[model samples]
Target chain A: MRAFAHTPFGALSIAILRGFVRDRAALFFAVVFPLMFLVLFGALLSNQDQSEIDMITVGDVPLLEDLPADAREAFETTFEVEESDDLDAALAEVRDGDADVVVEQKGDTLVAHYTQTEQVKAAITQSTLKAYVDGANIAASGQPARFGFAAERVEDESLTTIQFFTPGLLGWAIATSAALGAAATLQGWRQTKLLRRLQLAPVSTGTVVGARVAVTIAIALGQTAIFLGLGAATLGLKLTGSWWMSIPLVVVGTLCFMAIGLLAGAIAKSTEGAVNMANFFVLPMAFLSGSFFPLDATPPWLQRVSDVLPLKHLNEGMLDVLVRGQGPSAALVPLTILAAFAVVVTLLAARLFRWDTA
Target chain B: MTAIAAKGLTKRYGDLTAVDALDLTVAAGEFVGVLGPNGAGKTTLLEMLEGLRKPDAGEVSVLGEPAWPRNRALQPRIGVQLQASAFFERLTAREQIHTFAALYRAPGSAADEWLERVGLVAKADTRVEDLSGGQAQRLSIACALVHDPELVFLDEPTAALDPQARRNLWDLLADINDSGRTVVLTTHHMDEAETLCDRVAIVDHGRLLQHDTPAALVAAHAGGGNLEDVFLALTGREYRA
Candidate 1:
């Protein structure tokens, strides 16, 4: 027990944490930078309502359309299209804001107009028009009749930007704090030959690495808590999952990122080079893992790229608990991936680390 | 009993040989100094003996156990002051020493006492980064000696100190030696090697050029002048980086 207490890992961890607190620059980069990013990303994601538009069907247009029997039956059940022949009048109604959108037909052309110049509205109108044109084409070709497009009003839950960004911010905070705290500190220790000294002591390397991982996890959790508290109090964001679920995810994510940091520190020959390596890995994870914005708009191949990032799974797990109010079981895939990442990186770091100045 | 024994020890880094094949032994309770010029492999030999580095081809035994990776039981029995051992910048000198002291199974609780012993009591609470070069060196010594090991390895311990501080450190080291602990140190200062070491090994270009008492070496090679003249005769006046 006495020997265990003096293990290099725990002592180094405590020492590193104390050093971080005393260093104003490190404290700013480790603690404050992520908070600032959270604020920025939160502000940007605040307007969810603007991304969805209301679909207001005008009137019965079935009587005007030369619909096939099967098409007419499907259209009658799905839509309440207006019968107004005055397409200009209906478009004017949309232009006047009385309706969010208006759809009409004019000599083999389907024209859809929106009241507001919203990207969501434009997308919905274009898709609906395409469906109508395709239906008309099928009917003219005397093929089996298909239903015309029917716009359904998607009543999306209006979430503030901060609420939408909270999960991503949490992931970013965990990654930044864990990676910078462990990797950068290790590099500095190596540069000064402190690690070589410690290696000569009665301490094991496992103990040293374990202690650093523990401290990094603690710091990461503190970062997560700060973001959660400020997001809730200041931005009205809420974490819907239980503490038992969220806390474990935080721990797993911290371990995964800390391992990556250790590997980076071990492989980098100098402090300057370590800094460059950390930025090289962490920046890509941040941007591509949907920390700042939704990756849903990106292509399928890009989404596949995000799947390999630990931050992506971290964010997904956080969203599951915070947004979907799911349990730990609901996050098994992400949790497993994070654990796997931690194990692999830890092994790599341990294998690559050099105690002496090479 | 022999506290340290090395046979045909050699270490090489690529094309450069850091520690050439060498045979050395230190009896228990003896104070030995390894004297050499820059790049003479004095530090490298010390590292291998201290179990911080493995010899490419050699057998090293410290307290009857192999020296590379060091037997855990033998660790508490040996203390090492590396050529550039560093402390956490934010930790007070006392904290740093106490932390190291705790590593031993039966360490003293009087960290401040060790600091005072090293002439750092006034700066016990000062962070390591705030200490002067001499003060930091003293603190490093205090850390090494805190556990009161049976054998101590000091490498370049007085390299960057003022004359007064260096003298004080020498007296402290002598006191430690008088207490019946073996001291293995490396230094380039001929006067220090002459005054403090019971036996001296002069090495150059990774090989042992001479091994005997400072008096005996001078009598043999310096025409009875001094260890410096003996050293110059063996290593020559050429500068090495």
Candidate 2:
């Protein structure tokens, strides 16, 4: 038992991580790729007031004559409506910083114009128009109508996009790094006949495999740390939970992904084949696991498909803690699924793992 | 007491029979070689004996323990050097040996001495990826012997070496054998078998064709000329693959 306890899992993992860090190219892909995605997406999603038109202005309109008083009030509440002296001036406001959209009454029809990009302006106009129309209908029917849905503003505690993505990226980094590292290591060993040499020794296959997995986990943790630090510094991703929650999530993610890597290494007949297999598993998981995008808007069937991926559970667990400020107890389902994934994949890898080249 | 013994050992891979029913035995401290052609199942036989592979229909005893899924207690007592055992590319030769040594409860401090013995002392700090092929092979042997096991298995230890390196390895093997440990090696090189092995087992298509002292086999088959002719006679001039 003591001999098994000292089987180089920890040391081997550290060495593997060091080797990965030493490789600048691998480090960039493993750590920088997902971070780049986070920063790019975060900037796109940030609510900073970069554009000039934060409000829309109206001109040449009898305010409450064409629409009911209640409808007009609903419109005013929904949009920051400004009154301008002339049509040209209102259009100018639309073009300049004052208005996001200009609603000018030409005879009876309202012409909405804005310098805001089509997508942004269109979304604002659609929501405001819907509220105004609904309010008008409610006034006609003599019923009270709400203008906009109550902004369920639960304290200012929601995690930023970066915070939500950081843990997912951490999971991705660990999985890909471990899978690639273990597969490549195993292939190279097989090519050099090092595995065959070890086979002849008193060392069990389990020991060799355990060491490789340990090394992979260590490398993965290092990759995770690098990305987490970068996300915190550059993207302001925060971890609301204690280290207990974070560390175990990282460990479970590492074990599950390392198992994937071992299976790839075991099944591949050659180094090139192993590389292809690694890509086959890593690439799809990256996209489908909601690592880069939200799965909320995706179809239900797609979400079910994603549920089978180890990254999905990892990402959900991370989001639960970092994004939702929930404890591990809330993340129990994802954690359990991830643990099962780790155990199943590891057992399969061990069974399928071959030491000989053939 | 016999250090190693095999009775009707056989192994098959799907449609191909890698090793046929064969019987062999080696007394303690005897240096034996399994010499055959490229696909003669020499490796398969060695793997079976080392507990890396299970025999299809035979029994193997190594130091009074069955070889397959080897008894844990008997593991530290046996050393094996595969023809192509791999090492961590990032780990230096010394670190690799030390890591393996740490796996055992009681290990020896012969890693540095073994490195020096194999002429790899200067390259001790070199990673396995950076070492030359011959250096890597030497390091593999050093790793196997670091714990000072009583029985050693060497499989094609000198397959792709230059003449000087090969001679050096032969000398190293001779020294290892001289330390009064039993050695069972496999090779395709008849000269290696003739020069290094006290007794040689000639196998073909996984079956034992002949087994005897080098001189006795040659005298019995080649009229006392050379082991190569005896090997050619045992295994015809046909490509394996």
Candidate 3:
């Protein structure tokens, strides 16, 4: 006389899925916000120096000529410093995107004009010219040029900030969405007495928890696809590793965050408390895990601390596969750390879950 | 045979004991009502028997088997309607009930049948959040019964219902009882107990004061007044809210 004709897990998942899809706000945050971040960061970092700043010298700029032949050759190789005698035409070329900066010499001063909107290029050009002038004056004063260093990248291909940031953004988006989403959802279920009611059914708690975790992982997979697809399509994102390696990394990261969310739900007594607790855990991790900037920019001690966090592992592992083009084996350390965190937190969540509000 | 029997059930929360040494027995095919004021541990007691909570002390048997956490065999044999059960917010009433029904492995298309039984067939396609309180209550009841268990537990099923909705639920419960299923419900409404229950158990301060046929309890404790007077006489008039 039972009312159901099949296993409840599928039906239960379908019902729960409708809730996620119908929640327009959650959908927007889970899907659109990450892509939005990608687009915004891509636009900001698009024209950043992939190789070197391009400049044009006009009116026999002595600052450009005063360099030693080898130094001049290196400068021309590092920076596209082309010579043009016509000052007005050089300015026109700079305005028309033929050059990043236009420089001229008048008396003892070296005058430089740059595109107003190209602040990064303008700053680098100004600093480079100033350094050359300082070096020339030192050599003229009967002293070896005091300071000069050539900038070279260790990697074969130069990378933009966006390339470094995309993996972090991907990790952040998936982790926050899965963790906060699970916490809020489970707490709400407990608040409404749904968990209690669910306990009365024939299904085991493991079955229910498994269904939820599976659904979250599935959603996280979709999140990965959207971010990677959008990043590669529009942002010139290149994946050198077995790009498919990101799949396992995202899956493990999803489990890790979901387990953390389950722990939050276990501790929180109410829906609001669950959401607040999730944000409390996730927001700080997002900022510290190099989601918005390079980890190298952070203090050495702070980076060391971040290296132990799950989010940092996720971000770094993803960066290895996506940006660094390293295979899965290259990210073994971080992947193992994330897997361990997932196993530990999932065990804790199972031990502490409260089906009833009491 | 007894459908449910609890021996010296006890539950304590920190310094507060919600249910203290409570004993109860329910027979097969009977309609029983647990009557108590607010905070009388009625929910705690029912939850323990429903296997949703564990009593610090005591043993319980439902359908001749131990009823405790993870009593898998006993689960599908009982149905429960919580006071404020929430459904998936976006699921239509039918889909919500079907989801619950699916858990019990009930026959196909059971949700529509239960929705019809609860007089909610008209709202079957509506999302749970869009339903009125009464409609939602009916939907909750329908979901509880969608599995068609031999025993049913309903906690304050008619608390927020309008008079007409309350009457409809009374009729439904009476019908279920008539069909040879045991029904246990807790309520503050004495009139509901007088009209619907075959037996009423009065409780206060986490202890049972009386359990008997409603009419017999009235005749014995009412001093010639009605059943409500009997309830008031045994359980006092202090606001337990």
Best-performing candidate as measured by lDDT: 3
Clashing residue pairs found in predicted model 3: A2-B106, A3-B106, A4-B105, A4-B106, A241-A325
Q: Is candidate 1 or candidate 2 better by TM-score?
A: 1
Best-performing candidate as measured by TM-score: 3
RMSD of each: 8.6, 6.2, 5.7
User: Which rank order by TM-score, best down to worst?
Assistant: 3, 1, 2
Candidate 1 ranges beyond 4 A from true positions? A1-10, A43-159, B105-108
Query: How would you encode candidate 1's per-residue C-alpha lDDT over A1-358 as one tens digit per residue?
Result: 4454455555566676787788887778767887787777666655444433433433443323666686567545544444455657767766776555666545455556674455666666566557666766776799886554455554224334675578887788778768766777788888877787778778786776777777777887787778888888987786675535767889999898888887888888887777678767887898899888888789999899999999999988887777666776877888899999999998999899777667
Write model 2 residue lDDT over A64-175, tens digit each, in one string.
3467665566555556656766778767765665567776656645566766455665576756665555555676788666554565554357656677677776777777
TM-score of each: 0.80, 0.79, 0.85
lDDT of 1: 0.79
Q: Given candidate 1, what's the lDDT at residue B23?
A: 90
Q: Taking the tens digit of each residue's C-alpha lDDT, what string does model 2 give over B116-223? A: 788887887887778888888888888778888999988789988889999999998999899999998888788998899999988888888998999998888886
Worst 10-residue stretch by lDDT in candidate 3 chain B?
B83-92
lDDT value, residue B194 of candidate 2: 89
lDDT of each: 0.79, 0.75, 0.85
